[model samples]
Target chain A: MAVTRPGGPVDGSSPDAVSIAVPERASTGPVVARALRLLEAFSDERPTLTLSEISRRSGVPLSTAHRLVAALETWGAVERDPAGRYQVGLRLWEVGALAPRGPGLRERALPYLEDLCAVTRENVQLAVREDDEIVYVERLAGTQAVGVHIRVGGRWAMTATGVGLVLLAHAPPDVVERVLEGPFTRHTPWTLTDPARIRETLAAVRTRGYAVSERQITSDATSVAAPVRDATGEVVAALSVVAHHGNPPVSVLAPLVRTSAGGVSHALAAGRRPRRPR
Target chain B: MAVTRPGGPVDGSSPDAVSIAVPERASTGPVVARALRLLEAFSDERPTLTLSEISRRSGVPLSTAHRLVAALETWGAVERDPAGRYQVGLRLWEVGALAPRGPGLRERALPYLEDLCAVTRENVQLAVREDDEIVYVERLAGTQAVGVHIRVGGRWAMTATGVGLVLLAHAPPDVVERVLEGPFTRHTPWTLTDPARIRETLAAVRTRGYAVSERQITSDATSVAAPVRDATGEVVAALSVVAHHGNPPVSVLAPLVRTSAGGVSHALAAGRRPRRPR
Candidate 1:
């Protein structure tokens, strides 16, 4: 709803060095931010960490980290591993499953996504725009030669991915401007880093009802994406099929991807039982 | 790792009146607990709540709720809906997906779970033990006259469902004792609530290598489950298939369910990629 709320923690950065962590900045840091710092310290790269590591990474004093972690463990937000190290907890996962923009959307779109994955035999992906970045909601790997390396919760800039293009096309104007005025990351020689070229690509995506990214993220894959809309006729997400480079031409794959996206939109519009939380 | 760490916030209670909320109890409430209270305020029934609702539900002061929510929002643990009401956030979902006992285990076991679901065309479930309860990790619905109402992340006592029984049979002695010395909940007339009968049932499960619950949760559904083990051969989770009562019979479903659970155990022991987080 609102990235419009606060700006410090969700930038996908390890905010271990939070603004309040400076001793001179505040004699006593806000406990809430320190708690969040403890959470931010746990990442995909390091799923389990010792209490000492937590204190070091979060920049909260060892004793403060101990007290805060005690509170977190009480809430089932932080759990210990077999080795007495901390990891994310299943209780937190249970609550996270309630996130409307994450699993809530993913669960509704899964059947259609699976259908596309089955029909295409190519990497099928679903993503939603968050601020200027696109976060993958679900991805079904195809049995094709080109196997995608992106995971379900992975994030990527809007410049090099297919779903990212479709989402960027429907994003707010300010978001578009923010993405355009970027220090674009170049993944390959064919990757689009030029702002003008990306602008041209957006128009083509709108006109053709899909997006194509050939040899962008990987030299072996070509991605075609389409927008998935909600009942309000707003594009809430994007779906794509990343196929082996030109094996199934974009012309052949585009309709399949668009149809799947449309099916997901239809499911969203139908107001079906969306794997309702119990 | 250690529910052994703390005990106040996660009894699945709203905890609106945390111990520190009493003015006489503490001059300053722990802000970490207060922030967690704000999180506990959101539920499946009330996935989106206003600032005032949060304050009321958390029992945190109005200004304090405002401050804590700002921090939660910044960390992507909470988000504002289109109507400006708060719901869980995608970043939180991303972090939660890293939980080993939840999605990590489920992702590894999914292929086998799907195989059972497709072959039997019956509801398939995967669950793990949490204290004296079972928490569903994933559930694939089947097209049958007897449809299960349980949702993923839903919890049940170790007495009601097949997965629960299997998990409980393999539980620690103290946990077993804790469950047995209980005012057991009976979901149906067929549900076994007597301690001696439950102990007999546990022996049967260990001997037969599967657990069967007939018309326990619902009259029309009969569930059969098998234990899934880790490399150490510990029962880490349970797998099940809830079928139309007496249709496939426990005889037919048991072997299939056991095979699938074994498959999952094999996958786990392999130290597989496990839908490796990016």
Candidate 2:
């Protein structure tokens, strides 16, 4: 049975990655690729796996899987669960947290995101465009937030979220075109699926410097988002606040989000966290 | 000039990792170990590197480094910046976020951590024991927090901070013995160095259900920490709130921190996030 899948892999299928041929000889390139593919075999659902399960999922032979896993364990890349199943290790998380696009961005934007969440008491999200999809970098749900829950590293289509739309509007020509080519998954009736409407929405986001997405995921929730730029004036990421619709209205939230996004952009450009008075 | 080193590696010296004889042939295990060593070469101080830098740091030859880097880049283990220097990639970050000890613990403990930071307006830190050290899982700084800045995955000695003391108190016997056999580094005059005092402090923490570290890290800061246990009642993590020493006194902060830690423990026991009200 298919198990250990969480929304699926963001970098594409692991099986295809593991299919790189290994010569009858010892080649470090193909072997390293296979080992990395084994890492891709893990997901939110399948956080832990037995040796056979790992071998099956990664397509690495059982003997090689054993040896590769041993080496990874030695380096703290994978840890054994209580049931003796392999799980991702803390050290790997430490190394990955160095990624400039993920935790590095989150570190700079968190203070502003916290401010947005506090002001609106709503769900605050920060995301960056990756290919035709958007990957959430940070998500803070307030104590009284609406029914909006987003996972860090969760991927969604550019048309499905306010931050996604803002990122989509500033995305490269090919990325914009690819996103506009529809087969969009609809979450609610209010989710934008029509290519023409989405195209118009993108244009408006560019003109207004913000995007408003209402009832896209839930009927009670509405989102207002703004773009975050780098020193190069790039739409590196997008920030959004999701709250109950018509409670405060989108106009009131847009300026707050835009200002916070701008603050984050400034911090990113300055390359230092803004110190607060103690 | 030994550049691009963070507080140094957590697992051990990584040059030893690369010295894993890459047989005159192609051995996948040793090669994968070498590539992982390249990852260890990156730190907070050096998040990006040129190809020559990577080769020099990882102890891998230039030609082999190029091929290995290519394979790694294909799998999104590393990425190239606009300047063509290599950095940790977002896809690797996404995969690493799946580590239960890191993001999973952080996700479960965050709401309570937010509540603590909000209530005390201080810095709240969560940590878990790894080997002979304590690895921080999360740190939230309140707007009015005191001067405490702990990186999410930063490691420290088991006797340095409140959370560290709490974790150290409950660690396995062999681990405790190793920590007690001192060559202890002292940070401040008040920082505990006497093994007898440290042992007594550990005993007191067990009896009190919490720990107090006053001016251990900074002259103005004091941290009160409590243990977070799983359903099995095993101490899996430590939660601490750091603030200006004796402002509200440890008497006031102790119960609050202990309660928050209990809530986190209950949440971990249930294995589901406590639902928040709207």
Candidate 3:
């Protein structure tokens, strides 16, 4: 009989929630890669794991998993509960908070994101592209707004959300091509899967300075997104607002999302510039 | 001449911004500890560092630093920029988001935090104690609220702020004793320095189920804090609201803080209890 883990994805079926691709190890030695694989084993769906579960998920021998996990626990990369289950630790979170693309970007954009959420009373999301997928950096829920399945640090396909579209549109040609290739998961009937249509949508996003995703992820919600640029004018992130479908036209939200994105870009540029000499 | 790194503390001076303690090695081999030390070298003041700088700050030999940094880069724990400066990478941030005591707690407490900030128009902070220091997990700044220096993942002394006092008050006796034996830095004239006074304050915090810090961290701010308990009734976190001095009496904020904390406690309890069989 197969042992079942509480939150593990069922066999032969992808988890319908946030879909994050585990980072592939490059030239790192096997020991380091194995340690990282252990870290990757914990996810939004399965935040805690037993030693045997970690060994199985990471594809490391049980003894190796035990040794690596012991090191990780010592270094505070992972913590063990009273019941001996392992989860990521606070020290790792503190170091990760220094990531320029993660908390740093979110910190610079938060005031504007809060402003957008307050003004529209809708869900505001900030995301950046990692590989071909979009990783949500921050999300502010509008208290009484439409329920959203997305969470911070969650990942989704580039064809299924407004932020994803904006990021894919500004991504390099190779990345765009890679994402537009076959094998897309269809979240809803409205999710854009046709390569030609997705290409056309990317072009329109470039022309309009924003993207509108209508009932792509869920039937009751629509999202509008715009690109956030850095000092070099490269689009580094995407900002979006998801609201109840048909309550406000996409045209109405486009300007708000664009303005917020611009505000974030300006803040980023200002922060990057050196102070003038006295 | 001493070579100064960007984020290293100046002679006899503390970096007043974010203070994150480096994790100590716990009987793990020296290599893992050394890699963790390299990560600890990056801070809010110096988010990016050159290879030589990392070597110097972490006190690792250049060849070993290069090897370990290469591994870290491969594992996406660190990333290099065009200028060859290394910073914390997005993959690590994604993993860190799984920490139960960090983003997990913050995610559950955010809506209530937003509501408190909306109603009070004050700086709201959620924090948990790690070792003897207070690590801020979330801080929601109200528009037009008093400016605050605390950031998420930043650490502060257990005697310095409202949330810190609440957490310290409920902490184990040895931890409290360790904090009280400190050569405390006085940020303001009103900061409590006498151990007797601090003990009284702790007792008062326990009795009242709240704490009020008047001009402790900054002269212009007054903070009211309450404890957040888990399902087991353990004080796992603290919630606080910092406002401009003299704007609202501590009495007015105390009840609000306690209520929001209770709401969070209830939410945590509800989340932890096993669901009844359908």
Instruction: Highest TM-score: give the candidate number.
Output: 1
Segments in model 1 whose C-alpha atoms lie over 4 Å from true places:
A1-29, A271-278, B1-29, B143-145, B272-278
lDDT of 1 by residue, B49-148 (tens): 8999999998866765776788788778899877788999998888888888998888888889888988998889999998888999999877653668
DockQ, 0 to 1 scale, candidate 2: 0.31
Q: What is the lDDT of residue B267 in candidate 1?
A: 93
Could you tell which candidate, 1 or 3, scores higher by lDDT? 3
1 or 2, which is superior by TM-score?
1
Model 3 CA deviation exceeding 4 Å by range: A1-28, A245-247, A273-278, B1-28, B245-247, B272-278
lDDT (tens digit, per residue) of candidate 2 on B54-127: 98998866766776787788888899876788999888888889998899888899889989988988889999
> Order of candidates by TM-score, top first?
1, 2, 3
Q: For model 2, state the Cα shift of residue A107 in Å.
A: 2.0
Q: Candidate 3's residue-wise lDDT over B91-190, tens digit each? A: 8999999999999888789878989999998889999998989999999878768878888899999898999999999999999999999889898999
Residue B127 in model 1: lDDT? 96
Task: Please state how well chain A of candidate 3 matches the true chain A, as a TM-score.
Answer: 0.87
Cα-based lDDT at residue B106, candidate 3: 87
